[model samples]
Target: MTTKNVNLVSHPLVQHKLSLMREKDRSIKGFRELLNEIGMLLCYEVTRDLPLEMVDIETPLQPMKAPQIAGKKLTFAPILRAGVGFLDGMLALVPSARVAHIGLYRDPETLQAVEYYFKAPHDLSDRTVVMMDPMLATGNSACAAASLLKARGARDIRFVCLLAAPEGIAHFQKEHSDVPIWTAAVDERLNDHGYILPGLGDAGDRMFGTK
Candidate 1:
């Protein structure tokens, strides 16, 4: 489903893997592998509209014009720990894409995002940037990460997550309406502690076997 700035992937493969991830008894290795597979699928969805240009090429039989992605190589910016889970799969699809790391953690009491580290290519303004995370619950961390990217001159930015809550999507649109969001599913709502209910739990914990 496509909304104003949110795109729900909803592919059968994505939905099936997501349901497996949501199971409380799923093994850490299984969860990690599934997340990686979904990341690759999401990467395919988000880059579907990237511009393409025809180039001269020679097939074994004859010469021909072939299509290749146009413009500068894109960048994948993952939001710290959980976001890293999506990195390998995305990189596997776009091996030449650049990578930027944005480290932000949510404050438990206030449910706000706090940044601790950031690093990116200096030519961010020249390339498309995709910010990634496993979950978008409160939306604070995603917004903060986008703001940081903007400050660094990232003009074309996109956000991708595994799951999202309605409140989180609303909050994100209110803050960064221009940045599009892509996810597998938008669940019911946030709980008292600012977590997506029926979410796959803390993604970082499940992926890393942490408490």
Candidate 2:
């Protein structure tokens, strides 16, 4: 069920959609739509263990007690700008969840992740933080982003991605063993350029057609 704390969303729909997205020449509309659909499904998988509490509610026929998510609400921290691709669909499922943005870019020559922007909810420490990034390749930015959130007082955190590479997961777990990861697939390896082998390509470019 858990591999190095990376939970793969293996539902049939997620599997099928991810396969479609991996095609060579998908349109922007198709890619974006499929990503959203997968995002929504991933939301279901990641938050499966959210704490719940009994609450009294009135049904159409009678009053009854129901269970609702309890204690801390959620905060979605998207590692931009590709992470933004998963934002809308995730929010669609958890409409009340707040969003945090962290902008980072990997340097071409050095492959170092550089932070360009950061904005997060003030009550991060009290909420469960779900960090979103479509691909986990080098794990440089993902680790840095997790550290940033911790420094800013975030205690409970998790990560979600569309596909993850073994090297990336190892690097990320080396830095953060407590924060669990969720992905649609655990890819085989990272290419020489720090890209996931057989990856759907640069997710941002695929979504926006910059490629």
Candidate 3:
């Protein structure tokens, strides 16, 4: 089955930054910053289809007409706690957007996603929601989170991330055919350890300086 849509942006800035993020030796600060920056770039691609409506407005010297987003409330949902790293950058670009958080972890044995936290806007059904998670390693967590969001009545869902492995993307496609993915890079595969091959390591640990 096809997932709604998965778009891997190939812009130069995104590609260069993603390469840096994939290096094992990159500094934690650098990695975190790149995640945020890439998130913004991905945000641009993800929001491209947002509907706009023409509006007449006053400019510094005269009245001018312009278009602004029309008829769609936007909600930015970040999968915690690593996803929080991308949240700030997205918010900077979309200051008026509402925020949601999903906290889940995969069981080492069962490999099933277990949700421990989830909170979103009350009017999710009317909003266009963008879900952010930096790494799509196994796709279990992201897919599960997306399912939860759909259950909460969110429509026009978009999933954005920094890196994705083919395995992860395939898994997401199977599970979330209704939602399209927007990401910077799709890596080769997942390693035996559940890490994406050549991945920068645990995103949360690197972002927060945790061991």
**Best model number under lDDT:** 1
Q: Residue 140 deviation, candidate 3, in Å?
A: 0.9
TM-score for each candidate, following the candidate numbering? 0.98, 0.96, 0.93
Alpha-carbon RMSD of each model: 1.4, 1.5, 1.7
Clashes of each: 0, 0, 2
Task: State each model's CA lDDT, in order.
Answer: 0.95, 0.92, 0.87
Candidate 2 deviant stretches above 4 angstroms = none
Candidate 1 Cα lDDT to native: 0.95
Q: Give the backbone clash total of model 1.
A: 0
Per residue, candidate 3 scores C-alpha lDDT tens digits across 1-211 of 2434778799999999988887878888898899889888888899998999999999999998899999756899999889998887888899999998899987888777899999999889999999988889899999999999999998778899888888888898888888888888777778887888777788888888885
TM-score of 1: 0.98
Tens-digit lDDT track of model 1 for 83-172: 999999999999999999999999999999999999999999999999999999999999999999999999999999999999889989
Superior candidate under lDDT, 1 versus 2 = 1
lDDT of 2 by residue, 85-147 (tens): 898999999999999999999998998899999999898999999999999899998999999
